[model samples]
Target: MNGRSIATSAMLYTVTAATLVFIAAPLLVTMSLSVSDTQFVSFPPRGFTLAWYGKVLRDPDFQSALSFSLWLASFATFGALVLGLPAAFALVRFPVPGGAAIRSLLLSPLIFPVLVTGLGLLQLFSMLGWGSVPVNLLIAHILVTSPYVVRTVSASLMLADITLEEAARTLGASRWRTFRRVTLPQIAPGVAAGGLFAFMVSFDNYPVSMWLADAQNDPMPMFIYRKATGVFDPSVATVSTLLIGLAIVVVLILDRLVGLRRAMGM
Candidate 1:
């Protein structure tokens, strides 16, 4: 190979390594601290033990936070899928006047400041007299996560042949039947990928949830933030490590099921 090709390959390798290190550094530190025998968070743990894991498992507050997070992620993802996929189909099958602007509006959540969205939701809900604990959180999560579903399903629709649906319809198949058999399978992977992203968004979200959830309804991320600020306990590390692990597990499952490379445009 030419020297230019060699230099390009070396540059790519360096960038890849740097990116991996940047992402993994915090996770590695958090995992190490979770095992540390010390009560405080520290790097290069003085001693190692499993007590932090035990403490986390036994803690009711941790359990409640985890449960709330799971519930939020699941419900929010479902809401996004139900809302986004139809909108995607309509946008593609029957483009409206000003459709390009409409698509941008659909994805506004992706670019808007999350903190501002949180404040807006808080104000809107307060005006409507429903700024209670979990409802506000659910509303914010759904808003943030819907964009992922819209973007993903729209990509899948673009890749799928519109003729397949038309052909099915011409052959005595009802539109609903055509979609159920011909259209849905082709885009199912993309939908799943979008749902995975939605779940991850809800799971990892803090900025909007921070404003919405009360002390009683704080999700796991909020719980971690509280502990990190208040107690600085090893269990905070444990909780973070678990959240990271959960994200990895969900990604792996989806990767195996749908081949993440294709869903991600790789």
Candidate 2:
């Protein structure tokens, strides 16, 4: 390679290394602190211990929040898949009236500020006399996460070959059968990818959950925020490290199931 090309390659590598370091340093520090024996947050451990992790695991409030977050994320993803798949098919296949407007309406949650969405939902629910905390939060999560599923599935459908469905229909297959056997298999990766994204978004969501969450029933993010901001302790770090681990496992599962590049449309 020419000297200029070599210099440019070196510069790009340096920049990429620096960017990774910048992103990873805080997470590394948090993980390090989680094992520190110190009573308070401290950099570079005075000693090492797992007591904080034990404390976090034993905490009833933390357990409650974790359980609620899991259930909420799971159901939100399921609801998003159920609703988003049909919306995607309609938008991609049919020449529905006001198609552009309908697509925009479906995807508005992707652009709207979470705080605004949460506040609006709160007022709307109050007016409708829906006082159930779990139900309200579930609805909010579904609304927010459905856009991801719709966009992913629509992209997958756009790339799928249309002739397969026509061939299936010509060979004595019903519409539902064609979709189930041919169309769905083609878009399964996108659907799974969207579900993963939905689950992650719902799991980490804080601002929306903040407005809708009840006093006794908090999600993991809100619980972590409260612990981190209100009473500073290494226990927060331990819990955060565990959450990071959980996120890593989820990403690995997504990669295994969908292949990361394909999931990202690369």
Candidate 3:
């Protein structure tokens, strides 16, 4: 390549590396704090000990929060799959009569701040006589998480060949049958990708949990926030690490299934 082109490419690579480091810095800091033997959060932990990890593992509160986060994330992912898959299909297949508007409406959650969405849902729940903590979490999670599923499934639909679907419909198949027999297979990867994102969104959720979680039984994020605010506890580090570990595991699974690098348009 020409000298100028090479220089530009090198600059871009340097910028990208810097960006990645910036993004990962906080997580690294948290991990460091979690392992610190000092009374306060510190870099270069005074000395490392597995005591905090043991404490976290032994604590019932942490265990419950962990379980609560898992099941809630799983349920939210299921809700996203059920609702988002059909919405995605409709948006892509028709692409008519304000399809863009309809798509926007479905994905409006992405535009709203998470705190606003959670607060809005809390208000709606209070009005509807379903203002319990669990109910609010469920509604908030479903609303926030569905957009990922829609984006994934929609992308997959756009990527796939139109003829494969047309051929299935031509064989005297019901629309549902055609979808099940043809479209489903092609979109499965996208659906799985979306589901993974939904899981992470629900699992890592902060704002919603702060507003909607029960005073007595907060989800993991809320639990972490509480611990962080009340005092510096190294066990909080274990919880943070565990949550991030779950996210990493999900990314690895997605990569194995469909390569997250490709999904990110990289």
Candidate 4:
């Protein structure tokens, strides 16, 4: 409506466009490289083909790494949910002494550097004789991912109306029944969002997995790193594109089931 207002709007639009380009440029380049007919990684790819995708898909090592990564992410998400739900309820619903301290302790994993956390876990596990690679990795992942669940679920709990629970209790409903019928529905979006974050974090994790993973239990990130370093080719780009595609699909599904803004506590 006014010159100053128009100028502000134009500046905002420019900044938004620049930010999106900054974020999307790398993904676009990676996707382009994945389809490049060139035998090696190159920008402004010469021609286009999907052979790299096919080759990477058919590779046994790739298949194994993908499978392991999926399994690890699923379990880590589940573990995060298991620990997060009760912690969230307690933090949100109860007036416990030293509540802030407890919450900080639970979320400290997120504050500490992941590389340091991984090293510490590795040393602790060795000292405790926890030799199973998969088990140790799962525990470490759970520790890191649970903080997401705690944060999301606690936010949801704080926003959830207390009246519904009280009304259910007035009707002689048990605590568990009230939670199942009323509380869970309200917080389902938060749980879903938290689980999605946990899964993605675990799937993409390299620093933590680097310390914990063995040759036999290597996840996709480690596998990709090895592939990229060992052979400079489009296949690695193909793998990365597939991962990006997976993340997009997962987000689309979540957005369909639960409004993305609501799920994300926006």
| Cα lDDT tens digits for candidate 4, 27-48 | 9999989999997898889898
Model 2 regions lying over 4 Å from their true place: none
Would you list the C-alpha lDDT of every candidate in the order shown? 0.90, 0.93, 0.84, 0.94
Write down the worst ten-residue block by lDDT for model 4.
257-266
In candidate 4 the C-alpha lDDT for residue 258 amounts to 74
**lDDT for predicted candidate 2 compared with the true structure:** 0.93
Error of 2 at 163 (Å): 0.8
Q: Which candidate, 2 or 3, has the higher TM-score?
A: 2
| Alpha carbon lDDT at 256, candidate 3 | 90
Each candidate structure's TM-score, on Cα atoms with residue i matched to residue i, is: 0.95, 0.96, 0.91, 0.97
lDDT of 4: 0.94
Off by over 4 Å in 4: none
Itemize residue pairs with steric clashes in candidate 1: none
Estimate, for each residue in 1-266, the C-alpha lDDT of model 2 and write its tens digit: 99999999999999999999999998999999999998888777679899998899999999999999999999999999999999999999999999999999999999999899999999999999999999999999999999999999999999999999999999999999999999999988888888998999999999899899987779999999999898788999999999999999988887887675696867
Q: Which pairs of residues collide in candidate 2? A: none
Displacement of residue 39 (Cα, Å) in model 1 is 1.6
